[model samples]
Target chain A: MSDFVQSLRLWFAPGRIKDEGETPDYRFSLANERTFLAWIRTALALVGGGFAVDQFLPDLRWGVRVGLALALLAAGVLCALRAVNHWVRCERAMRRGEDLPVSRFPAVLSLAVAVVALAMVVVVVFGWAGR
Target chain B: MTEVRDPGLQPERTRLAWRRTTLSCTVVAVLAVKVAVHDDITAAGLTGLALSALVWVAFLAVAHRRIRALDAARPHPLSYRGALLAAVCTIALAVCGAAMIW
Candidate 1:
């Protein structure tokens, strides 16, 4: 438990990663940085989508509008957290000469997005049919 | 130690990615500001707008620094503090965006 706490405490230290292992290839590190930036962009997109749905869909039922927006916002929060965590893990693995850590987060994020898209479709279809 | 080669233009790609993400962050901040202004500005709305602006500026600084860092012959690994700050800023912007929505 203490070890975990210590590592967690060190996680945000400026030079924690450098102290672990030899600096890996600079190209690989740059690639990791790009991946992190891409994830940040994804998070931004989700947040923007949430705001658009809320502002533009004035005719949407209040409950449905807030529900959809909240879903997107929640996803954005998760994606942002995952972005930083994954970046650190990948960098540490590369420095240690180990295989890059693999995760199911991409699959999970895709599934969440698909589910949200389906919900939007349903809302649009039902609203249109009623008109 | 052998000097690293840069035939793949990795640093350039990374720098571009930072710029793109910064642009996206700016868009999100702008939208939040629009929302705050379009509606009657409540205290909460004003607070959220201010925070969104602050977070956006912080993120821009971090992104700008990283972009410049990429120009080095061999850029250092991203510091833990920098990545954490960037992530915090992005998440905070999302919260501000949500605040603007409802």
Candidate 2:
């Protein structure tokens, strides 16, 4: 347990990864950096969307309003965490001449966003009809 | 063979990505501020807004440093710490946004 904790701390500590692997092509690193930034931006947009729903939709049913806002905010938080961890993983892979890490996060994130959009549509359509 | 520097403008593209992300972060901060002030300003609201502003500035500084670093002939890889810091600030800002809503 101590070993795992130490490794986790070292993984997160600043400047430790620089010495581990040979420097790969700068272009690949830059690309990875850009991808990380893109994910961060996506997270920010989701958070902003959450705040917008809560602030702009005063007439929204309280339960639905909080639900949608919390969903979006939660997604944003997960994306933000995923963004950094993936960035570190890719950078490490490139340094070690290994294959870039891959995962199903993009698909999962898409599904999450779609579900939120669908929920919004249902709430809007039904709420309008009820009014 | 004298390899060309920046053969595909990758550094420029990366720099622009940083800029765009920074702008989006700024937008989020603005939105948070609006929400914070939308209702009567309480001490907690003010504190949340202040923390969000601080996080935005920290992220901005990190992005700006990386942007400048990309101008080199071969931009150094982003440090692990820098990337983590950027991500943490972003998450903190999102938490602030959530708190404002509640």
TM-scores, one per candidate:
0.91, 0.91
Q: What is the TM-score of chain A alone in each candidate?
A: 0.91, 0.89
Q: What is the C-alpha lDDT of each candidate?
A: 0.83, 0.85
Q: Whole-model lDDT for model 2 versus the true structure?
A: 0.85
- Predicted candidate 2 versus true structure: per-residue lDDT over A1-115, tens digit per residue: 6733544665657466577788888888889999999999999999999989988999898889988998898999999888987887787778778788788999999999999
lDDT (tens digit, per residue) of candidate 1 on B1-102: 255646787777788888898899998888778767776878978888889889999999998888888886678867777788888887897787776676
**Model 2 interface RMSD, one decimal:** 1.0
Residue B82 lDDT, candidate 2, scale 0-100: 81
- Candidate 1 structure quality by residue, lDDT tens digits, A70-108: 889889999999888788878888878989878899999
Distance from true location, Cα of A80 in model 2, Å:
0.9
User: What is the Cα root-mean-square deviation between model 1 and the actual structure?
Assistant: 2.5
For model 2 chain A, give the 10-residue run with minimal summed lDDT.
Answer: A3-12
Evaluated against the true structure, the overall lDDT of model 1 is 0.83
